[model samples]
Target chain A: MQLTGGQILCESLIREGVDVVFGLPGGAILPLYGTLPQYKDRIRHILVRHEQGAAMAADGYARATGKVGVCWATSGPGATNLVTGLACSSMDSVPIVAITGQVARPTIGKDAFQEIDVTGVTLPITKHNYLVMHASEIARTIREAFYIASSGRPGVVLVDIPRDVFQEKAEFGEYPTTVDLPGYKPVLDGNISQILRAARLIKEAQRPVVLAGHGVLLSRAMDELREFAEKTQTPVITTLLGLSGFPQTHYLSLGMPGMHGVAWASLALDEADLIIGLGARFDDRVTGDLKRFAPNAKIIHVDVDPSEIGKSVATAVPIVGDLKRVLKQLIANVEPAIHVEWMAHLDQLRREHPSLYIRPTEKLLPQYVIREISEVTDGRAVIVTGVGQHQMWTALHYTFKEPYTMITSGGLGAMGFEVPAAMGAQVGVPDRVVWSIAGDGGFQMTMSELATIAENNIPVKFAIINNNFLGMVRQWQEFFYNREYSASGYTKNPDFVKLAEAFGILGLRVTERSQVRDAIIKAMEWAGPVVVDFVVEEEENVYPMIPAGTSVDQLIEEPQMVEERR
Target chain B: MPKGPASHTIVALVQDRPGVLNRVASMFRRRGYNIVSLSVGHSEQPGFSRMTFVVNGDDHTIEQVRNQLDRLIDVVKVSDLSDENVVARELALIKVQATPYNRSEIIQLVDIFRANIVDVSPDSLIIEVTGDEDKVDSLLQLLKSFGVRELMRTGRVAMLRGANAYPGTPSANGNQ
Candidate 1:
C-alpha cells in the first residue's frame, strides 16, 4: 500500500517500539502532526512547552527505561533550542532520537521562513545524523537512526525531513529488519590476551581500586562489576554519573571521586597501586591534576568505545569491548584475593575526614534537605538534578542501591535539566517515585515546564533548593575572588511556592530545618506533582573540593576563614 | 619519528554520499586534531570514495583521529599508512615568473627535477611536478629564485607497496 511520508513516519516509529515521544508542533511539522490521530493508540505524543524540554525529556526517558527515547521539533528555532539538550545527551552517552522538520526541498537554501541547517548544527554533538532526501528512505533511515543511537556507546542522533516529503507518497511494506552500514559495527568481545593481562594486574596488585563509570549502568554490567569487586575484595569508587551502578551502602563502595568528590575516595585513588577503570573516562574533573592523578597506579581501562580508552589517562592494559562481557572474562580468569590492609587504610582516611559529616546548625542547610529526602525515600527514588551545589549535594548525600536510580547532566553540566528530565523519568517508569532536585539558580531556568507537568499530571516531586544565589559560584568567589558576590546573588526572586500554586500544583515552603522532612513527606504523599521550596542557607558550600586543576592532596576540607557578613 | 609530535598518514574508504567530507572535516576540527594535508577522490568501488589525510600528532592523537574517523557512519574503513612501506606521491603546479636572463636556468632546473612545463606565457612558466612532498618542495625552492608567481599542490596520495592490502582478486595491480 502507498502511504504518505507522515504515515510512514508514524508506522516506522511504531515498528521501532516507540510508545511515547516528547515534542511540540509548528508549521513545518503540521503535516506529521495531522497524521498522529491515526496511530494515537500506539503512540503517545506529549506536548512540551519548549524544544529543549522535549530533548531532555527524551534523554531522561532513555536513562530511566534503558530504551531508545524519541523527540520531535519543527524547523529553525525549534531545532536550535534542542542544541543544549543534544549536547547534554551526547556528553552523557544517552540514546535519544531527535526528529526535526525542514523546509520543502525547493525552498531549502532560499532562506525560507523556518528553515535551519539542523544536521549541520548538530554534527559535533551527535553520534550521527542524516537529512532525509526522499520519503521512500524514511523507514530505513529511522531504523538506522535508532540502531546507531542505542548500539554500542549510546548517544544522540537526529533525522531531518523536509516538509514537502511528509506529504509525498511512498509504497510501504515491512520496515527494514537489518542495518547495512559496514562501518557501524560495535565490538562486543574483548581480546582474550588483554583480559588475561588485566587479570594478571589484578592478581598482583596489593592496593587496587575499582573506578566504575556510567558505562556500567548503560551496559547493564552492575552484576558483573559487583561480582568482580567482591571476588577481588576491591573497594569501588563510582564517578558522579556512575552513582547507582554500584551499591553505595556496600562496604566496598566509596561514594564519588573527583574535584568535588569525597575526600577519602580521592585519597584512596591517590595511594592505589592498581586502578581498574570500568566504562569511565578519567575526565579532568575526575582526575583533578592529570600529572599527579593515580601516580602510583597502573591503570587497566575497559570500555566499549575505543576512542574513550586512554583519551585522558594512560592505560597499562586497554580492553576494548562491552563492559559486561569484559568483566565476565576477567572474573573467569582472575583469582580471588583479599586486601585487608588496603581496606583498613581507606577506613582510616574516611575516619580522619568523615565523608558525610553535617555541622549542627539551626539554619536550613541544603545538605540537610538532601539528606532528609534520601532518608524519606529510603534511597529508592529515582533522583534527577540540575547542575550546581544541589547536584553535588545530591551526589554526595543520596545513598543509591539500585542501577538507573540517579540521572543528571554529567558531562555537559547543563542547568535547567532536572524539571523535564524528571517528568520524562516519571513517564518512562510510572511505578517508580521520581524527584527533581534543583538549585535556585538552575530551577528558574526551566521552571516554564511546570505548566507541562501540570497538564500531563506527570507525578514528579520537585524540590527547589532555594538558596537565593548561585551557591557554587558564590562559594568560588568567597574562596578566590574575595567575596565580590557580583551577579551570582538573586536579589529579586519570585516565590516558588506561589509560582507552583499559580500553575495549579500543590505547593509548600520549608524555611526552618525542622520543616524540610515534613515538606518532603507531604510532597511524596501527594499523588500528583508537588513543589517544595527549600529555603536553604545562602552561604553554604560543597566541601572537600580539589580546586579546579589542583591535586587531591590540596583538597579543601572546610572553610579556612570566616568572613564577617550579615 | 621522535617522541614528540610527528606526521602520520591515514586513508579512509567512505560512502560516496553528500556531506561525508563535511563530517570528516568537522570531526577533526571539533577534536582539535591538526591536519597537515588532505586529498579525496572516487575509489575503485563505484559507491565509495577514498580519502587520504596527513595528520600531525603523537601516537595517542593519531589513534584518536583514526578511531574518530572510523566512528563516522559513512566511513567504511580507516588505516594508518604512516609506518607501512608504501608509495606516496604529491603533485604540484608551479607558475614561476621567467625573464630572458633566468629562463634558460629555470628550464635546466626543471629538467633536472623531471618536471614538465604544462603552460607558458611570455614572462611565466607553469611547471608540473609529480613526486613526494620533499621533491615538490625542492623544485619549488629552486624556482623561487626566478620569482615563483603562484603554486598549487595536491596533497599526498599513497598505496601499500605489496599486494596484501588490496581489495578484490589478488595481484589485481600486478604487483605480486
Candidate 2:
C-alpha cells in the first residue's frame, strides 16, 4: 500500500505494539500531527506541556513497564528542550526512542526558522541517533532506533526527520526481522569459568554484602538476586536507585548504603569482608574515598554493561553479561552456605544505629511525612521522587516490597523528574497507585505538568513535601559552607493547594502534625487526581549522614546537644 | 594541565558509520585526553574501518578510556598497540629548505631512512617517510637541523606481528 511517511511511521509504531506516545505539536511536526488523528485508536498521543516533560514521561513509562518508551517533539526548541530529559534517561539506562521533526532537507543548513542540529547535539547523550533525510528510511530507521534503544544496555535513541520527508510518499517494504548491526552484539551469556570463579568467591566470603543497583530493576533480576543472596546467606545493601530491587522488609535487605544511606548500611559496607556488586556501579557517593571504601573487601562486580565493571573500584571478579542469566548460572552451580555470624553482625549494627526520626523539636518532619504516606499506601504504591533530601527521606522511611515499585532518577539527579515521570508511570500501569513525591523546590521546576496531568486525567497522586527550601542543597550548605544559605530558601512561595486547585486537582494541605493521617486518607480517597501539600518542618535535616566527601567513619550521627529530637 | 605526555597508541575496529569518527573524537574530548595524532581508513573487512589515535594519559585513565570506547555500539574491538609487540608505521611528508648547495646531502639523509623524495622544487624537496614513530621521530630530528620548511605525519597504524587480529575478524584466531 502506498502511504505518506507519516502513515508509514504510524504503521511502524503499530507493528512495534506501541499503544501510547507523548509529544507536543509544532510547525515542522504539523504533518505527523495531522496523521496522528487517523491512528488515534492505535496510538494514544499524550500532549505534554513541554518537550522535556514528554521525554521524562516516556522515561518514567519505560522504567515502570520495562518496555521502550516513545516520545516526539518538533524541531529546534522542542528538540533542545528534550536534551536534559534524554540525558537523564541515557545516564540512568532507561530505554526511550525520541523522534524530532527536522527542518526540510534542503533548509537544514540554511539556518532556517525552527532549524537545529538536534542529532549532532544529542549524539553524545543518546546511545545512537539517526537523521532521516529521505522518506524511505523512516520505517527501517524507526525499527532500528527502537531495537537499539531497548536491547543490550538500554538508552535513549533519537531519530530526526525532515518536515518534507514526513509528508513524502514512499514505497513500503516488509519490516526486517533482524538489523545487520555487525558490531552491535552484546555478550548475553556469562563465561562459565568466570561464573565459577565468582561462585567460589561468594563461597569463600565470610562477611559478604551484596550491593544491588538499578540494573536489577532494569533486568528484572530481583528474584535471581534474592535467590543468590539466600543461597549464600548474603546481606544486601541497595544503592539509591536500587531501593526496591530486593524487598525492603526482607531480612537480607540492609537498605541503601551511601552518602545519605542509613548508618547501619554504611557501617555494613565498611566492615564487610566482601562486596558482591550486583548490577551496581560503585559511585563516589556510595564509596566516599576509593582507597578507604570497603578497604577489607574483595569486590565481585556483575553487570550487563561491561564498561561499569571496572569503572569504579577494581573488581577482583568482573563478570560481564545479563545479570539475570549470570545470577541463574551462579545459583545453579553455587553450594548453599550459611553466614549466621555476618547476619548477626549486621543486625547488631542495625540495632545500634537504626534510621529512626523522633525530632520532637521539628513539628512536621519530612521523614514523618514519608512515614505517614507509607503508612497510608501500605508501602505498595509505585513511588517516584524528584532528587532532594525528600528522596533520601523516602528511601529511608518507605517500605518497598517489589522491584520497579520505586522510580527515581539515580545517577543524573535531575531536580524536576517525578512529576511527569509519575504521570507516565500511571499511564503505563493504569491499575496501580503512582505517587509523585516532590520537594517544594523540585515540584515548582516542572510543576507546569500539573496541567498535563489534568488534561490526561491520569490519577497519579502528588505529595509535595513543601519544605520552603531547596532542602538537599541547604543541608549541604549548612554542613559544608558554614551555614551561608545562598539562594536556597523560598521566602515567597505560592500556595501549593491553590495551585493544585487551579490545575483541577483536589488539593489538601497538612500543616499541623495531627492533620497528616486525615489529609493522606482524604487525598487517597479522592475520585481522580489528588495533590497533598504537606508543609513540613522547615529545617529537619536527613541524618545517618556522611557529610559530603567524607569517609565511612566520618558519619555525623546524633549530636549530644539538648538530645534535641529525643 | 601539563600532564606528562604518556603517549599511548590505541587501535580500534569500528563499523563504518556516518558519525562514528565524531563519536570517538568526542569521547576523547570529553575525557580531556588530547589526541596526539589520529588516522582512519578501511580495514581488511568489508564494512569495518580501523582507527588509530595516540592520546596523552596515565595507564588508569587510558584503560578507562579504552573500555568506554569499546562500549560504543559501533566499536567492534579496541586494543592498545603499546601493550603488544606489533608492526607500527607512520607516514610523513616533509619539505626541507634545500638549495643546489647541500641538496644531495639531504637526499642522502632521506635515503638512509629508506624515505622517498615525493616532490621536489628548486628551493626545497618534499620527502615522504613511512616508519614507526621512532624512525619517523629520528628522521624529523635529523632533518630539523637542516632547517625543515614544513612537515605532516600520519599517526601509527598497527597490527600484531604474528598470527593475530581483532576479535571477530577472519584472521583473528591466526594470522593466516
Candidate 3:
C-alpha cells in the first residue's frame, strides 16, 4: 500500500505491537503529528511537557512493562533535550526507541531552523542510531531500531528522520519479521563448560553471595534467581536498580549493597568467598575501592553483554549469555547445597546493624515517610524515585516484594526522573498504584510534568521529600567538605502543594510525624494525580555509607548518639 | 597475554558507512584506550571496510578494546591479529633531502630495502616502502640521517596464514 512515511511509521508500530508512545510535537515534526490522528485509536500518544520527560516516560514504561518504549521529538533542542534520558536508559540498559524529526534533506547541512546532528549526538548513548535519508527506509529503520533496542543487552536507540521524508509517500510493505544484522547477535545460551565451572564453584563455595542487578528485572529472571539462591543456599545482595528484582522480605535477600546500601549486605559481600555476579556490573558505588573490594572472593560474572564481563573486576568465570537462560542452565547443572555457617554469620551482622532502623525524630523523617508509603501500599505499588537521599531511603525502607515494582534512575541518577517516569509507569500499568517519591530538589527539576499528569489524570501519587536542602550533597559536604553548604540549601522554594494545585491536581502537605500515613492514604484515595509535600528533617543523612573511592572498612554507620526507632 | 603494556593489533570488518570511524574513534577516546595507529580502506567484500588498529594496552585492556569495538553495530567482525600466525605489512612514504652527493647512496639504500622512489624533486625524493613495522621503522631511521623531510605510514594491516580466517568468513573452520 502506498503511504506517507508517518503512516508507515504508525503502521509499522502497530505491526510491532506498540500500543502507546510518549512524545511531543514541534515545527519540524508537524507532518508526523499531523498524521497521528488517523492512528489515534490504534496508537495512544502521550504528550509530555519536555522532550526529556517524553524520553524518560518511555524509559519508565519500558522498565515497568518489559517492552521497548517508544518516544518522539522534533530536531535541535527537542532532540538535545533527550540526551539525559537516553544516557540514563543506556547506562541502566532500558530498552527505548526514540524517533526525532529533522529538518528536510536539503536543509540538513545548511543549518536550517531546528536542524541538528541528532544521530551524531546520541551515537555513544544509544545502542545504535539511524538517520533516515529516504521515506522508504522509515518502516525498516524503525523495525531495526526496535529490534536493536529490545534485543541483547537492551538500550536506547534513536532514529532521526528528515521532515520531508516523513511527508513523502512510499510503498509500504510487510514489516520485516527479522533484521539481517550480522553484528547484532546476542548470546542467549551460556557456554556449557562455563556453566559447569560456575556450578562447581557454587558447590565448593563456603560463603557465596548472589549479586542481583537490573539484568534480573530486564531478563525477568527473578524466579530463576530465587531458585538459584535457594538451591545453592546463597544470600542475594541487590544493587540499587536491582531493588525489586528479588523479594526483599525473602530470608535469602540481603537487600541492596552499595554506598548507601544496607550495612550487613555490604559486609556480607566484603566477607564472601565467592560472588556470583548476575547481570550486575561492579560499579564504583557498589565496589568502593577495587583493591579492597571483596579481596577474598572470586567473581563469576554472568552478563548478556560480553563487554561488561571484565570491564571493572577480574572475572574468575565469565558467562556471556542472557541471565534467565544462564540461570536455568546453572540451576539444572548445580546440586542443592547449604551454607549454614554463612547464613548464621550474615544474620549476626544483620542483628548487629539493622538496615531498616529509623531513629525516632521530633521532625518528620524521609525514611519514616517512605516506610509509611510502603505500609500504605503494602509494598504492592510501583514505587519510582528521583535520585537523592530519598531514593536511597526508599530502597532501604520500602519492602519490594515483586519484580519491576521499584523503578528509579540508578546509573545516571538524573534528579528529575520521578515525575515523568511515574506517569509512564502508571500509563504502562494502569491498574497498579504508582508512587513517585522525589526529593525537593529533584521534584523541582521536572515538576513541569505535573501539568501533563493532571491533564491525563494519570493518578500518580507524588511524594516530595522536602528537606530544604539537597540532602545527599549536604551530607557529603558535612562529612567531607566541612559543611560549607555551597548553594545546596534552598531558601526560597515554591510551595510544592501549591504548584500541584495550580496544575489542577489535589495537593497535600504533611509536616508532623503523625500526619505522614494519613497524607499518603489521602493521595492514594484521590481519583486524580496528588502531590504530597512531606516536610522532613532538614539535616538528615542516609547512613551505613561507604564514602566513594573508600574501602568497606571505612563504612559510616549511624551515630551512636541516635538510638534506633521502634 | 602480556603482563605489561604492549602494542596489540586488532582488525575489524565493518559496514562502509558514514560515522563508522567516528564511532570507533569515540569509543577509543571515551574508554581511554590509546590507539597507536589506525588505517581503514575498502575490503574484498563490497560495502565493507577493513580497519586495522594498533593499540597500546595489556591483555585485559586489549580484550576490552576488542569487545567494545565488536559491540558497535556497524562492525561486522573484530579479530585480534596480535597472537595469530599472520602476515602484517605497512606502507610508508618517506621524503628524504637528497643532496647530489648523497643521491646515489640513498638510491642504493632504497634498492636494498626493496623500496621505490615514487617521487623525485630537485632537493628531495619520496621513497615508498611496504613491509612490517620494524622494516619500515629501520628504513625511516636510516633515511633520517640523510635528513628526512616528511614521513607518512599506513598502519599495520594483517591477514592470517594460508586459509586461516575470521569466523563467519567463507574459508573459516574448513568451510570451502
Interface RMSD, one decimal, each candidate: 9.0, 6.1, 6.0
Candidate order (DockQ): 3, 2, 1
lDDT of 3 by residue, A1-566 (tens): 89998999899999988999999898888999999999999999989999999999998999999998999999999999999999999999999999999999999899898889998899889999999988899888888988899988999989998999999999997778889887777778888888998999999999999999999999999999999999999999999999899999899999998798998899988999999999999999999999899999999999988888888998889898899999999999999998999999999999998567888667888899999999989898999999989999999999999889989998999999998899999999999999999999989888899888988889999899999999899987887787789989999999987888899999999989999888888888888899999998899888878889987787778754223210
**Best DockQ among the predictions, by candidate number:** 3
True contacts kept of each: 0.48, 0.41, 0.46
Q: List the residue pairs that clash in candidate 2.
A: B163-B175
Q: Name the 10 consecutive residues with the lowest summed lDDT in model 2 chain B.
A: B167-176
lDDT of 1 at A299: 94
Docking class of 3: acceptable
Off by over 4 Å in 2: A559-566, B1-7, B56-59, B162-164, B167-176
lDDT of each: 0.90, 0.85, 0.89
lDDT of 2 by residue, A1-566 (tens): 67888988999988887998999999999999989899998899999998999999999998899999999999999999999899999989999999999999889889999999998899889998988887888888888888889887889999999999999999887975678776677677777877888888888888999999888888889899899888888889999889989998898888988888888889888988889898888998899888789889888888777778767787788787788888899999888999988888888888888466556653877888888889888889999999988998998999998678898888889989979899899999998988889989888989899899998788988889998999988977776677799999999999999999999988888888889889888877776788899998877787877765668888766644214322
Model 3 chain A scores worst on lDDT over the 10 consecutive residues at: A557-566
lDDT winner, 1 or 2:
1
**Candidate 1 Cα errors over 4 Å, as ranges:** A561-566, B99-104, B166-176
DockQ of each: 0.38, 0.39, 0.44
Q: Write the per-residue lDDT of candidate 1 for residues A19-52, one digit (tens) a residue.
A: 9999999888889999999999999999999999
